[model samples]
Target: MSTINCFFNTYQRRLEDLEKKLNRDQLLVADELTSAERELAMEMVHMGLLENIAQRVFVTKQFPINDFLLRQLVLGQGVYTGNTALYLWHLSDAFPYTIQLAVRMGYQVPKQRYLEWTENVQFKQVRQPRLEEDVKKIDVAKTTRKILVYSPERVLVELIKSTETDKELLKAGIQRYLRSPQRNLNQLLMVSKRLKAEKKVQFIMETLL
Candidate 1:
């Protein structure tokens, strides 16, 4: 079955169970209940008029990004990279529907597995010179939760490496970032050298500056 179908089935079952429990005990003691159980109980109690509590039901959005990322984390850890990282950092205004991610080689998660979960995310393998140290946790815009992403320095190198296909758009993106007072030249230089994209990065910055 598709991932969405499976998740919906689980959700429906949980709601049905919650409804049954609420019916049995109007004053449900949630102190020992699971987080989900407690949340459903509260929603039933506070979300509407007292008469509607018995019929209280909630629906979920179609594959919300937050839920998708949480599931991705459960499957295997990953770091957002490329333009996706730039967008999350607020350096780029373009929003991407398909998020780019990199997972460590040791995770044993096949590239094909992400396809089974959702089409909105793409995954790649992070190779040598790109260790876990290169990634850091940061909040995605407007979200309270945090996610792992490549630092700006590593993101610059990744964009440089993609110049073959990305060409002009990336060049413009890099130029815009360089103009920002927040750009860290030293860190960029260090990571570019490690990624073997120092020369390319130097060339790009020189032309823009």
Candidate 2:
């Protein structure tokens, strides 16, 4: 079968799974599903094949999809990462208009193709599995929906690698994260060491604190 045909078939299966499993006529929240289940549901929502009920909240097709729905879909093997994840963790003052996501390197779709399909979201693909503690499911205060996000420590590791290119934004992001109580020194140190950013991480941690 053609790739497009297979893609649509997969989508149809996901839609069927959603209808059979979710069964609710009301707004859907993140707490209701296991991470695996949520991933499946989010793929359909991101594709514009399923309409979301509210910002980051998916409901059945009975509801009309708003433009804002495009910003809320962080689906298909992707996890919120970098500055965007920091923002979701409430460590940054600025709320992003375009969502940033990280997917596994093995993800089938070209990352740029996602932008072509939906301009409100962006994707980055990484090799290897992420540390479990590096990701979390947190509530979206505005819409009462839950979404996946990277921990502050993990976000810092990502930012450190980008410092040469985005120095000002990296400095600002670190400062913002430091100001928040959510910053975990132990985890940050550990992750930084693992990612070979220990020196910079230590400098920022000590200088900022």
What lDDT does the true structure give each of the candidates? 0.64, 0.64
- Per residue, candidate 2 scores C-alpha lDDT tens digits across 1-209 of 99999988886786676666545433454556657557876776888655544334566565433333333353334677776776666666677677677767665654354444346566676777653447777754334444667777888787876743356666777877777677678888898888888998787777767
Model 1 agreement with the true structure over 64-123: per-residue lDDT tens digits: 345334534445467888878887766677886777878766556543644444456667
Considering every candidate listed, which one attains the maximal TM-score? 1
Off by more than 4 A, model 1: 1-76, 106-117, 127-129, 140-144
Off by over 4 Å in 2: 1-25, 28-74, 110-117, 131-133, 141-145
The RMSD of every model to the true structure, in order and in angstroms, is: 11.6, 10.1
Model 2 worst lDDT window (10 residues):
63-72
| Steric collisions counted per model | 0, 0
Model 1 per-residue lDDT at 63? 19
Where is model 1 poorest over a 10-residue stretch in terms of lDDT?
A: 49-58
